[model samples]
Target: MTGTAPNRPEPPLIAEPLTLPGCLKIFPKVHRDERGRLVKTVHHETYSRYGLISSFREQFYSFSRRGVLRGLHVQLPPAEQHKLVACLQGEVLDVILDLRTDSPTYGQHELVPLDGERGAMVYMPPGIAHGFYACDDSLLLYHVTTQHAPAQDAGIHWNSVGISWPDSQPVLSERDRTFPSLAEFASPFRFHPEGSPL
Candidate 1:
């Protein structure tokens, strides 16, 4: 005796809208089974197709428990760094701020909900502030265009950006807590008179 069944289709990758001054790049990975599925997180050639050419000099991974908040930071330029960020194990509410005084999106903010289950990557240009709230105990991995420069590192207070974060009094590190508010710090990157990157 045998039972009849209907075939199920695979779900397509979800690419969320890129808020101004922020971009989301999506790559489809082939899935095969019996053993385990394979997923390619990054491919230089594929990234080139999207006009991203900068090579990474450093890579970092951070693991945070739920309700933790990190960042709202940018490195001073010529030390400014570009980033390619992804969620590997759980989920995060990723937020970015356009800090270029001359950028059309200056002072504007964007939010991206990144999930490990949905292979998504965010491209953050230099002259922007980046941060995220751990929606669950999450693992975040990222590639940077420049090496870390402790002297040139700085950040804005996360609450100043106006993004509604998870309500349970976020756990913050001392450094993040001591960071200045956006209005108190002078931007280290130069923006054109037209509000664009110089």
Candidate 2:
């Protein structure tokens, strides 16, 4: 565990909605002490109030070096995921693309800067393509609503969505390089307007 678990749960932190539909940016309150700092990563009740009612079934974290870009990824249908992602060790330029066919913001993308020192996190709804650029040696913590399904794994090619990533060539896996371009993708997600359940 990075920060010691509190003896008693802390109060819920509020989140701000981003321009991208269904995406939210959260700044968790950090309590500092002589020992270090204590961060409350998730408060089920706080997230529930924000309509993120799904119970996370899995939690994972990843490490990336500067310039590494990891996605624009998604899973089809029954395997699609809703995620809460946080920076636990460094900073990243996180990006999201709306892939919902009925969304008015379909094809639009948003960029968010997350810093571990600030305890920042983002909530991504299923059907959006997500990726990040490591601004430093960074660690990301992820909480998701679904389990992994290799067969359902998919993505939009990182460079094809018009994101203005830093000019150095991004370090990418062969899989990320091979995903279809946004223009070439046939979206499978349908948009549920605000106030409707996803």
Candidate with best lDDT:
2
- How many pairs collide in each candidate, listed in order? 3, 0
Clashing pairs in 1: 102-195, 102-196, 103-195
Tens-digit lDDT track of model 1 for 1-198: 458676765433323336654355554464768885555656675556455544999989999999999998788877888787888878999888888887777778888888887657777778878999999999998889999999889999988767888754799999999998888878866454342211
**After superposition on all CA atoms, what RMSD does each candidate show versus the true structure?**
7.1, 6.5
lDDT of 2 at 88: 87
- Runs with alpha carbons beyond 4 Å of true place in candidate 1: 1-17, 27-37, 191-198
- Residue 132 shift from truth in candidate 2, angstroms: 0.1
User: For residues 1-198, what per-residue lDDT tens digits would candidate 2 score against the true structure?
Assistant: 769975876555768888777888887888888997778888887877778745988999999998899998888888988888899888999999999988888999999998888888888888888899999999999888889899989999998978998745999999998999999999999887674332
User: Candidate 2: minimum summed lDDT over ten consecutive residues — where?
Assistant: 189-198
lDDT over C-alpha atoms for residue 115 of model 2: 80
Backbone clashes in model 2, listed as residue pairs: none
Model 1 deviation from the true structure expressed as Cα RMSD, one decimal place: 7.1
lDDT of each: 0.76, 0.86
